[model samples]
Structure formats: C-alpha cells, structure tokens
Target: MMYVFLGKNVAQNRELAQMLTQFQLEFELLTYDDIDETILNFCMAHTNDCFDLLTDRLQDYRSRSDISYSELCQLILSDVEKHIKFPLVIKDDVVYAGLTNAEARSLLLPKKVRFMLSRQYLSKSYHVMMARKKVS
Candidate 1:
C-alpha cells in the first residue's frame, strides 16, 4: 500500500520518515510547498475538523488574537501551508498528524506485523513507531 506523508524539513519529520523507511513502507513525501487543494480536501473529509489535521505547533497560531478559530480553519482549508501541521501520515482512509515516536509505534506496529506476516513467517526485528489519526 502507498502512504502519503506531509511534513516540513524538521528533525522530528525527518526522524519519522527514517523510521518508515526502515520498515520498508512505501510513501510519498510532501512538504509545505507541495500541499494542494486535493490533499486538503482529502484531509478535511477524513477529519472532523481541519484543525484536527494540523500539528501542535499550529495550535499556537490558532490561538492568535487576530484570527478566530473559524478563520484559522478556513485558512487551513484553503491550503495556507504555514498554518498547516507537519509530519502528517495518510494511509488507506486514515490521516495521522503530528505524532510522537511512541504514538507512531503503536499505530505502525500492527500494520508492520501484518506486512511481515504477509511476506514471511519469520519474526523480524523491527523498531516501534507510534502515531494518532483523527477519524470520525
């Protein structure tokens, strides 16, 4: 299966990408500049609110006095890259945004296990990665 990864050129994003690579998971990486209307629409459709697709860092931007929550949401929906979050992982119909290592591990372990079993019965050594996705 192919996954879509949206993230910036930051340490955390890089680390997550590396972990996914080590798992032999195939994915397409998209930076802020690469975000487009189609991707935004997919994210909005899968998440309850567009903000649910953003990173914690964008939470601070959402709290700014100049913009209301709705306005911030609008900006995100409009694909305002700066207001968007980093390290977003989309697979099947699920979208994972701003996940920690532990969180990513929890989410990925099951999938990785499934992949390994699908390939070979051997128990392979694999690191744990965790993530969270806001699904309705």
Candidate 2:
C-alpha cells in the first residue's frame, strides 16, 4: 500500500484522505508541521551562532578563492546531488512508502498514530524517509 503525501494546503489532501478512509485503507499520515520543526532544528544546528561566526567561517573558506555565495552554494549542492532517493517508513513490521495525502492523513488522523508514525519516519534519513510500502 504505497502512497504519496500532499500538504494540507492542497485540496488534494481533503479529497485523498476521505477517499482513503472510505476505502478502509491501512496507512499513515505525516504532517508538514513535523517536517518544518525538523528542518528548523537542522538549520539552527548548521548555522553559525552569530553573524561574526558566519563571517569568520566564510572568510576562512574564501581566503584564497573569490567565489560568490551563490557559487559556494552551487558547490555544496554539487556534492549533495550524489545522494538523493525516495523516502519510506517501517512500523511494527510493515514498510510503507509513496506517501500520498491519503496515507499521511491516516498517520495524522490520530495523535497516537501520528506520534508513532513520526517517530519511525524520523528514524530514517530524511533523504529517503517516505512511506513506500511494497504490495503484498
């Protein structure tokens, strides 16, 4: 039962969740709020504590080169380009993926379900933490 997740802002979320429920689909939901917090935490950890700290790091890296910030970003992404993949999650025993709006609603419909789903979702690398389940 693989599904893909869509944001709540998308009308698709309401349609999909209702359709999935009517069909009695067994799945999970992952909300954007959870994702946002994780991203915020990561940014805070990666960013410098202060402007001076950031400048120092930038100066150290550009001591010899005259690369612009955009160029530096491109260099970073070039390195990241090598490691992109689909996301998935494992629970009790089943593995789920292709997390559409419906599936995410399943996970988010209930607080307990959402917590468990988020925990498992968080355990995996965000680079590939979708709930893609293999069909039985």
Candidate 3:
C-alpha cells in the first residue's frame, strides 16, 4: 500500500503522480477528505513536532463552519508542505523515504524496498527510528 500525501499546488501533486507513474507504482492520493486518527498519526509521525500546530490550524480554519474528521486533513497539506515525506510504501515490510521531494522521488520508488529499509536502519535515520514503531 502506498499513501501519497497531496500538495496544495495542483501541478506539484500532478507531477508527483506522474513521477509515481514513471516509477510504475500505483498509489492513492491522500487528500483532505482522508483525515482520521490514523491519518493524523501518520502525518504527525512524519512531521517534526508539528501536530499541535496542525490541529490548531484546522480549528482556526473551521472558524464558523462544521468540519468532518477527514475534512480536517486540509491542514496537513496546506500547512506543512516542507515537512511532507510521503509515498509511504508498505509491501512485504514497512519502509520510509526521505523528507525532501527530490529524495522521495528519486530514492524511494526505484530502489528495492528491502534495500531502503536496510539503508535507513544502517544509517540510523530518524524517520526509520520512528517508522518502525510509530508508522508501522
């Protein structure tokens, strides 16, 4: 399973989809309507100390209107573009990619999932440290 968090910019998200297509990997685009406790935790685990901030933004955005749990996911994409490191590829095992767009695009889909997992653990990457417990 691959969950791709979408960006605010249509073009960027489209490009990301195209990039995934080029890699020949099928993925589902995660949008505001996908928010939930699990999705929130996923974004929180991926983000660096920004969960409260995101929640607050969602509250602020609610303003005078009601919002569903999934509707609240607008915060993750609109507020934390720089923090997104999606294409959370889950197959035989759980594996995470880098925080940057370039890294996620270039380093994630091409390499074997096992290789990425081992490389992350070998380097002791912070995300890997969290992914093992928090993401999976």
Candidate 4:
C-alpha cells in the first residue's frame, strides 16, 4: 500500500504524515519543490486519464472543488479499505481516488497495471528509464 502525498509545505504537511501513521499507512511525502519533470509527467498522465471521468463526476454531484487535505483524510479514514488499493490526489479538497478503477470494474486496471505499454504508460516508462539510468 503505497501512498504518495504531495504536501505544500514541510510543516503543513505533517498532519498527513501523522494521519497516515495513526492509520498505519505507509507514504512518501513530496512538496511542490520536490516535483521534478519526471514526477510531474507521471502525475500528469494520471491526471489526464481521469480528466474526462472527473468532468463527468463533477457533473453528477454538488461538491466543493476547493477542499483541504485534512478533510480528505477524514473521508478516507471512514472507508480505508475501499480507498486503499489506488493512489490518491486530493487537490483543493476534491478527492479523486482511483476513479477509473473504483467507478468502473475492469475499466482501467488491466491497462494500467501492465508491465509495459498502453494505459497510463508514462509512469511505467519513467520508472524504466530511471532504473536503466541507475543500472548503467
């Protein structure tokens, strides 16, 4: 269970780290400055995959798009098992937790969790490139 948390500040971000601790969730924290091109590229790929789905979800509900991460933790705390499988992106309090997989069964999972190629391929490609770089 890998949780990648993007915190805006080191001090401000501790709440998430603590919450994860309270729930015994393992996570890596990254601030805005820590986002390199590679990480951003991977995140963007995920974002792009959910763009249309997000638009559709937004259309269905009356949700405040500008929610906070603290609030998101509470939501996840309510149903950890349901939210545990996928990575989370909680920006402005609008939580998109594995929407493609959660909303549709076998929708983006097979395509995404492959070894190489297709679906959200950028993250895999990035990892491959980095591994090759390290090996050499």
Q: What tens-digit string does per-residue lDDT give for candidate 2 at 4-103? A: 3334345655666576576565656554333333332343244343122122333355464677655644443343212111122333333333345556
TM-score, every prediction? 0.60, 0.25, 0.44, 0.32
Candidate 4 per-residue lDDT, tens place, 12-125, comes to 345445644654444454443343444333443554442332223233222566655445434434544333333344343233443332332222223434434344478878
lDDT (C-alpha, whole model) for all candidates: 0.64, 0.43, 0.53, 0.42
Summed over model 2, clashes come to 24
lDDT of 4: 0.42
Candidate 3 local lDDT, 19-90, one digit each (tens): 777767866667534545565566445544433334343445545467654555554545444433333333
TM for candidate 2 is 0.25
Pitting candidate 1 against candidate 2, the one with the higher lDDT is 1
Q: Model 2 scores what on Cα lDDT?
A: 0.43
Best by lDDT: 1
Cα displacement (Å) at residue 26, model 1: 1.8
Off by over 4 Å in 3: 45-100, 112-136
The residue pairs found clashing in candidate 1 are 103-130, 103-131, 104-129, 104-130, 104-131, 105-129, 105-130
